[model samples]
Target chain A: MKVLAPIAAHEELEMLAAAGAEELYCGIVPREWLERYTGAVWLNRRSPKGGSLDSYAELKRLVDDAHKLHLPVFITLNSPYYTAEQIPLVLELAHKLSDEIGVDALIVTDINLLMRLSQEKLACELHVSSVAAVLNTEAIRFLLNFGPSRIILPRSVTLAEIATITRDVGQQVEIEVFMLNDGCAFEEGFCSTTHHHTVGAFCTSLSEMDTQFEWAGKSFTTRRQNWLRRNLTDYREWVWYVNGNGCGVTPKGLPYGPCGLCAVPDLQRMGVASLKIVGREASPFKKLASVKMVRDIVNRTRAGVPKLHVIERAKQLRESPEHCAAGFMCYYKVDESA
Target chain B: MEWSLHIGGAHELASELWLSRFVEADRSQLTQPWSELAGRLLVTEFGDIRFTHCAFGNEFCEHLIPSVSALQTALTAAQQQQLSFTLLTPYVSNEGIAALRPLFERLAGNGGGEVVFNDWGVLNLLRRDFPTLIPIQGRLLNKSLRDPRVTPMYATAPAPSSALNVLQRSNLDCESYAALLTGLGVQTVETDNLPQGNDLSFAQYGLRIATYAPFGFISTSRICMAAGLHYRKADKFQPGAPCRHECQTHLLEYSYTNSPFGNRDQKFFLKGNSYFYAHTESMLHALFAQIRAGQIARLTWQPRLPMTVAH
Candidate 1:
């Protein structure tokens, strides 16, 4: 399996690559990250030297090392917006990712932007991202037609469904499933508006702390389909002080808490081209330990059997500093669904 | 009977020729290139052809749309005089819709042609803004398929694949698609590059995001997604230049499909499996065929058939 090591820093990338990492996925660089952060004074886009550091240079260095080691890289492109003002910049970066930097694929979320890339720009592989809400066959079929090189499967699937999906789709296109640490309540494809606040340019991920989404009157929210029946075309089901009613999205099925309940066996049966372990939030030691656990299971899966033991693994990883356990989201699923 | 043919004349071919300019810097290639492409388009008698007013990406929102007079000039000079063509714009943003009024006057200056829009807000907005111009909500607002889960992600031994479940499940998606059409009073739902077997037009009415795949033969398409697009509009010129390629992606690949091989597979879907968008287009052809032929096998929910009766 192509093991995608989710690293927090460039230094960690080398460590993971040495740990048999085949691919890497990372967040926006600090320099770039500071600029778009939504809050006026904090993230100055006009900053002359970019940010406090030229992280892109560091990023390029990491990319060079990965390329030398024969590891592919994917940059995260998940964000929320309507007009698609992101295309030109996206295209330019993709060009660099291919021509100079050489990142293997881009983990993207938008369709209109993706279509233009496939048609007009970019020579790199388009790996389907987790945020695209591609959960079902029709959704998969819809994305498949676009000719993505691989699909990063949603975190909501069970071992059985992944097997069925793998059986139907095949391993050639490459499937990157989240093997450890991270699962959300929202449908992976349709719901994102999180992580950044629009109206301002400084509400970066760091600033937007202590926030969680929940329904306004979920109990009162009608269970009926298409809440806007009287005005069928109108998607304004709920009046929002900010955006439209989830902008055609409903609040149902959003898990209320932790992710990672079915982590163990899930890693074993997914059969994706890569078994990715989401890091970032986890402690460094836990990050290393989590990678080791998943890598071991994946290596064993080649023997035609799957490995799992979420409860024990979670217990074992508790002593480490980066303690967001692999099954961190697991308990939350049960609590919310219950 | 031969299925509906989307034949492009000299005018329809111009958009592609304009796009081809970016690929090849040589000015000569753009000038007479379609002489060959148009010949290829005309001999194949088409039922309808489409000429969108805007470039496919969001960048075109700020630019001035080429005037209808310019479009008319192109049409007049084009080879095929008898062939019919139409208009489709994905979103029809406020800036674009305003530019469209004058452009449409030019497209219809020759006494007649149709203009169909894709965005829902644009449809409602246009009904208020451009009451005279014909509108067709691009599949963006009224999708060909939508997957609303009623059962667990995984079912007991042997159930329909999640890909097929949206089709089998409560037909909620079909109902939504048909109903929206009835309410909006649209002319047609635009779809391209559909699945081989199922036709969006006839298979069953459903709405979902579909992507375009110009290469490789894929009948199944991107049937699943990983997650959803989570946007945070912070800035365009943030400290570090935006990753040009990251901006190109309409939605996050990891966030959406389980099968985002878009760059490799060259496919995608907007709300759902944009990867298998070709299937959605194919489905549109089937629906158009059955609807035009006046035979809808399963009108489980036709929204409002009476309203759709063109005659």
Candidate 2:
């Protein structure tokens, strides 16, 4: 399995590759683009601190370094959608990444951009980012019109569902799965709220506070309102409802690293081309650790480790044994007991 | 200019109000001139295409998605009622797309209804498999960043020019973007009554525009607090966790405490699986002027109704 890791700079390239990153991806924000939109309207999903390369020259250097290591670099242009005004600049960046930088691929979600890239006939392969929300074969078939070479599946699907998709469309293009890090409680493409808060994404913070629920009628309000108010302390349960697991740095929380390492054997058997580890904004230390962990799993599974032994190893890698105990932290649901 | 009424389903807007039955089904029935309305937008399931407050995790939600039979029956009934139909769809997974293929094909077979697609996949499917179905861009895909935090800023005197520009610029405001969508077989687009307001200049771009009045969707999430209420534990607060359709049972109001500009005091309505806010009468009237001037060709009247959760 190709371990795709997030890249922020040339400095992290060698370490990432040495840590077993076979492929790399990052976002670029040129000075002109930043001056216009600022960090508020991110050209890509990551916030300003979300690991965007400052200049095209920096990106080109990163690409060159990855090429020396014989690794391909994919650029993320995968914001949910871009405005028409933003498209020309975005396309310019796409062409530069393809021809000038010699990047292997451009990860995109906007169909307008996808159609433009196809029409423009850029050099690099187009990768449908999970932001496009390609959840089904029909969605895949839809993306096929633009001719993407790889599709990074969203973190939301279960292993069974992933198996079904790979079986049906796996042969058509390279299928990628979220092998490690950053799982959203909600679907990425459909989420419209700005994730630009300095603390964390506002969507992820829904469970942290209480919001008053009001409506038009009296009896309706009285019954529903009083019941909800009475359960103010229990509202923490509701927070968990919004966040799939509670928000914490611990393994038990929903915002915690939702790892799919346990499901690697099945994913490989199903012909998944790559396992993605999200964390472009994370520290190099964290990125290196993630890469090492997934790389180790890839090495073991490829060397034909027994399922039982691999399962035991994966349990140790998790935040806590109980993190996967309920099968919630498993990026892809595995049938094995924790 | 045209005016159409949008309802969740026949359950909400029956042929006649079922006064004897229950309030949920009876209270908000369309009558009078609306009965003869030329177009009716029936949401079979809140389009998975949009971010809804309730999510069943992945694209396909057993609890949230409506069945093919239900959609077909609704379409046929709409036809009998002499109301033109526009099928609204959500962002979905391959399974959800596969599930809806028959329905898309059926729509094609049934004289090709207008399909309002929030997901590009649905649009692509229409182009490939069901070409005859007229495709309109749904409001969800009309992604103009509407952060409620900025509403108070717009209300303030000397509002920041940059924020104003961002607010005023609709995704369709760029002529080329509208042209691109037009090239993709979408001639019509739907929009929310945004507080920052819309620059309907896209009308000059040769696209027909529609807007939902008095209930602009600020944003939505699959991590629906409403769905979470039914879950006994945080671990159980996931998709396919045996929901009892708590969204239909109740509505929640959310307010932010640390909001800048006292924006937290603004109450956003959480109904079913989505967050919505009512537009002011003045806002509606101003938009009505645009409709009269033909900038916006259609106005979709969405009457507030009790949550009617469906299959």
Q: Give the number of the best model, judged by TM-score.
A: 2
TM-score of 1: 0.41
Misplaced by over 4 Å in model 1 are A29-54, A81-84, A197-270, A281-283, A303-338, B1-311
lDDT of each: 0.39, 0.66
Report the number of the highest-DockQ candidate. 2
Q: Give candidate 2 misplaced runs (Cα > 4 Å).
A: A198-200, A213-256, A326-328, B11-62, B67-81, B105-110, B151-167, B170-177, B221-225, B228-235, B240-242, B305-311
| Cand. 2 TM to true fold | 0.84
User: Per-residue CA lDDT of candidate 2, range A220-314, in tens?
Assistant: 54666766554443444333423434434443322246678888888888899999988798778778878988888888899899777787787
Candidate 1 lDDT over B1-311, as tens digits, reads: 21121222233334342322222221222112222233222223332223232211111111223445555654564323333434444332234455565655665565545455533334554456455656643433322122211111112224334333322221123333345454545534443322322234322443322222121111111111111112122111111111222211122111122211222222222211221112223334444454445433111111000000000
lDDT of 1 by residue, A35-90 (tens): 55322111111222221223667778877887888887776654322122234565
* True lDDT of residue B176, candidate 2: 61
